[model samples]
Target chain A: MIGRLNHVAIAVLDMEEALKVYRDTLGGIVSDKVAQPDHGVSTVFVELPNTKIELLEPLGENSPINKFLERNTQGGIHHICYEVDDIIAARDQLVANGARILGDGEPKIGAHGKPVLFLHPKDFLGTLTELEQA
Target chain B: MIGRLNHVAIAVLDMEEALKVYRDTLGGIVSDKVAQPDHGVSTVFVELPNTKIELLEPLGENSPINKFLERNTQGGIHHICYEVDDIIAARDQLVANGARILGDGEPKIGAHGKPVLFLHPKDFLGTLTELEQA
Candidate 1:
């Protein structure tokens, strides 16, 4: 079951500009951009009191977010992550409920080094959802 | 300055379907649907430990989310609300930094009955942002 709202990931064309809005303009405590080549994105964390806003920029040519950026040129909210206690049990429950799991239907070590899986957007009201093990 | 991430609003075309995904599939604590006719939307809150997810459905003829639902079809992330200690000060800071405030540039009572202002998506990398007084 979903426990906490982990983070909201926003795919941006320009990380610097995104930082300006979330960090400079909004006065959030932002982390330095960190490249996650494995995940094919560069990430910047805007730390809020209760949660985090992750600003993502495509890292390479085949980055997953490149397609999202194509449709949303200026960038957009890519996905919302929820923390789950037991990911396997959660996935099974979701599968039983007719919700599709994305990729190979296996949990991958996510950016935060936690097991995570992506759920099909169509099953989630067009919102791309990520479930991370708490 | 942005303090907490108050909530993330997801606009959905079908409230029942959205509830099935959030409550039944994902096992989140969902609140009963409450129609905010003044705001032209019906809202359901998925209470998470850290924050909340607000599921919105068009309530009236001229619902604000109607256009968004038209474009997305299946619904999508509408906006993210961040809490601030002083909304006026936050507005001035954002305005000074060249962020455009939506509407008449004055804070209005949000769905939560707190002063809130929406920022232009163009100025926010396509992510509609709302700032509410904490």
Candidate 2:
């Protein structure tokens, strides 16, 4: 079951401009941009009192967010992540409920070094969802 | 300054289908649908430990999300709301920092009964942002 609302990832064309809005303009506690080449994105965390907003930038030529950026030229909200207690059990339950999981239905070590699985957007009301083990 | 992430609003075409994904599939604590005709949408809250996800369904022909749903077809993330201590001060600061406020540049009573203002998506890295009075 989903426990906490993890982070909302926004794919941006420019990380510096995104930082200006979230960090300087909104006055949020923002983390420095960290490149996750393995994940194919550069990430910046805007920490709030209750949750964090993740600003993601395409890293390389085949970056995962490149397609998203192409579709949404101005950038956009990419996915919402929810924390689950037991990822395997959660995946099983979701599968049993006719939910589609992305990437062979296997949990991968996510950016935070936690087991994470992505759910199909069509199955989730067109919202790309990521379930991270809490 | 932003205090907390008030909620992330997802606009869905079908409330029933959206409920099936968030309530049954994800096992989130879902609230009963509350129709806010005044706001032109029906809302359902998926309460997480730290924050909430608001599912919004169009209520009337002139619903604000109607255009968004038309473009997205299925559904999508509508906006992200952040709580602020003083909305006027926040708006003034944001305006001074070259952020454009939507509509008449005045705070309107949001669905949560708090004074809220929407920022131009173009000015916020394409993310529709709402600032609510905390």
Candidate 3:
């Protein structure tokens, strides 16, 4: 089951501009940008008290975030991540309950350096949901 | 700034079906359904360790959820709520920083019976951002 709201990922056309909004405008402490090549994103974390906001800019044209930006034009909320105590147990439980795990049905190292898997947006209403190992 | 993530709101066509996904499928503990007439939506809260998931179904045709569900068809993430120490201060700061607040630029009594205000999606990279008084 889900433990806590890990972070909400936002796709942005420009990371520097988005950084200005969260850091300069909203006064959120921003983390140093990190390239997540496997995930095809360059990410920066906006630290909040209880959770973090992940700013994602596409690493390449083939990146999933690029596709999202293509549709939204202005970029948008990409996904919401929830932390789970056990990634494998949660995966099996969700799969047993008819929830589909995305990709190869295996966990991948995510932006937080934790095992993460994505659930289909269709199954979770319209929002793409991600589960991360706590 | 933000205190914590209050909840992530998902707009669904049918509350029961959405409930099944979060409650039965994902093994989340859900709250009883409540009709928020003023907000023009019916909501149910799925409690997690650190935050809550708010499931919203349009109460009427004019409801905002109705519009989102119409576009997404299968429903999706509507908005995310972040708790603020002072809603008024947060609003003022955001506005001064060129972020446009939706509605009347005033706070409304939200589902949690706290003052809440929404920021335009355009300014926040297409994510409808909600700020609630913590």
Candidate 4:
């Protein structure tokens, strides 16, 4: 089952501009930018007291975030992440209940260095959802 | 400053269909439906372990959600709500920092009976953000 809300991900055209809002304006502590080459995105974490905001920028032409950016030129919320106590059990239950897991249905090491899986938007009221191991 | 992530709001075309995704598929405990004529939307909350998910359906033809649904027939994530310890202070700081506050720059009672105010999407990387008094 889902645990704490992990982090909300947002696609951004430019990370620096996005940081101006979350970091300078909102006073959130911004983490060092990390390049997630495997995922084809550059990520920055804006830490807050209870959770974090993840800013993602497409790193390559084939990046999934590129397609999302094409659809949303101004950038927008990409997905929400929730922590799961047991990801395998959660994935099995979700799959059994007819939820489509993205990318070979296997958990990948995410930005947090924890196993994560993405759920298809069609299966979750049009919202791309990410499940991360707690 | 933001306290905790209060909820993630999703705009749905049909409440019943959306419920099947969040409640039945994901095993979320859903709350009763409530209509907010003033906001022109019908809302239901699915309580999760860390936070809540709000499903919003357009109540009237001129509802703001109707406009969002017109572009995205399949529905999608709308906005994110963050809890703030002092909403007035948060609003003042944000306004002074050039963040545009939606409406008349005032907090209104939200679904949870907490004071809430929305921020412009343009200022926050196209993510419509709501700040709720914690």
Candidate 5:
């Protein structure tokens, strides 16, 4: 069952500049930062009163974030994360219902060290759906 | 500074079937419902442990939700909302920075009885942004 929202993920071209906007402009405080070499990106988060906002920048050319930034994506909203008690169960249900899982076989550790998985945008229409076990 | 996220809005075709997915299938509890004649949407909400998920179905053909559904859009993610203390200031800042507001002059009372406004997806690439005052 989904519990709550974990965080909203936003892709950015320049992590530093985005940080300034989230921090200085928006008056949000940086809560955490991590570099996931395997995921090929570095991420930073700002804690809000109720939830968190995550900013991601791809590290290299082959990284997904890099390609997303290369396309000159504009800044706005991104993926909406649903907090779930059992990510594996939710993933299974989604798969059983014909949804595509972004992770290989199981839920992977996400930016905030939560078990997270993405549903293929094609299966979810144009929206990117994320299931997070918190 | 903004507060916690109030809700995430999903544009769906059938409010009843969507409610089934969110309630019976997802094991969620419907927390609220509202019909906004001005917005031309009848919304139902399922409250999670952490945040609320809203389903929006347009009331008629002229409603934006109707046109969105008529496109046979797939089921997926939608807008990410930020909770703010001052909707007017946030809306003004967003407008000053070249963002377009869906609300004409002021934030309108949304389905949940909160003041809300939307930013055009074209202004923010393909992503829709919402500002909610709680």
Candidate 6:
């Protein structure tokens, strides 16, 4: 079931500039940044008062973030992450309710040491959804 | 400057079913429901720890959320709301940076005593962004 919102993902063209803007101009604080080579994207997290804004930039051509950035005219929110108590059950329930999963049926270690699985954006409106199980 | 996230909108087909599931099974509390006849849609907000899940159901033929639900196979995250200090300045800066605004250039009173404006999804990489000034 849905607990607290983990974070909101935003796809940006320049990670550094975006980070500076979000952090310095907007008064957001950088919580962390990770280079997800497997996904071919680099991400920076800026923590706000209530939520964190995730900045994702594509690392290569085949990267999904690259495609998203290529299609994006301005930096926009890409996905919303929900912290769930049970990832498998959530996935099953979502599938039963006609949602599609994006990863190998199992939860994998995500950017911040939590298990995460991405829900396919094609199946879920044009928005990507992620489930993080702590 | 930025304030709290107002709500996380989600597009759905059957408002009743989604409301039941989110309220009963997920332990989400339905804060309020409104039929925005002007916007040609009905929305219900389920409050959680930090944010609310907004369920949007299209009401008529030309509803924007209708097109969204049409494209969406499964209900997904629609837009992330960020409360801003000033709407005009934010709109100007975003436009200067090549972001697109969806509505006519004025802030309107939104669902919960807040002035809201919609930014074009096309400019934001298919991710609908909203700015709410309280």
| Top of the candidates by DockQ | 1
Query: What DockQ, on C-alphas, does every prediction get?
Result: 0.90, 0.88, 0.78, 0.69, 0.44, 0.37
The digit string of per-residue lDDT tens for model 5 on B36-124 reads 77878887887877777778877765886665566547543456577888998887786676668875758888666788888776554
Cα RMSDs, all models: 0.7, 0.8, 1.3, 1.6, 3.4, 3.7
TM-score (all chains, Cα) for each model: 0.99, 0.98, 0.96, 0.93, 0.80, 0.77
TM-score of 2: 0.98
lDDT of 4: 0.89
Q: Report lDDT (CA) for all predictions.
A: 0.94, 0.92, 0.88, 0.89, 0.71, 0.74
| Model 6 Cα lDDT, one tens digit per residue, B56-83 | 8888888777666765656667787878
- Per-residue CA lDDT of model 1 for A1-134, tens digit only, reads 89988999999998988888887788889998999999999999988888999999999899999999999999999999999999999999899988999999999999999999999999999999999999
Q: Model 4, range B11-38, lDDT digits (tens) per residue?
A: 9999999988877877778999999988
**How many clashes does each candidate structure show, in the order listed?**
0, 0, 2, 0, 2, 0
| DockQ, structure candidate 1 | 0.90
User: How do the candidates score on chain B by TM-score?
Assistant: 0.98, 0.98, 0.97, 0.96, 0.83, 0.87
Between 1 and 6, whose DockQ is larger? 1
Candidate 6, clashing residue pairs? none
Which residue pairs in model 1 clash with each other?
A: none
Residue range with the least summed lDDT across 10 consecutive positions in model 4 chain B? B19-28
Predicted candidate 1: interface RMSD?
0.7
lDDT of 1 by residue, B8-119 (tens): 9999998999998888888889998999998999999999999999999999899999999999999999999999999999899888888899999999998999999999
For model 1, the stretches where C-alpha displacement exceeds 4 angstroms are: none
| Strongest candidate by lDDT | 1
The 10 consecutive residues of candidate 5 chain A with the worst lDDT sum are A68-77
lDDT measured at residue A10 in model 1 versus the true structure, 0 to 100:
96
lDDT of 3 by residue, A39-69 (tens): 7999999887778889999997688787789
Interface RMSD of each: 0.7, 0.8, 1.2, 1.5, 3.7, 4.3
* Ranking of models by lDDT: 1, 2, 4, 3, 6, 5
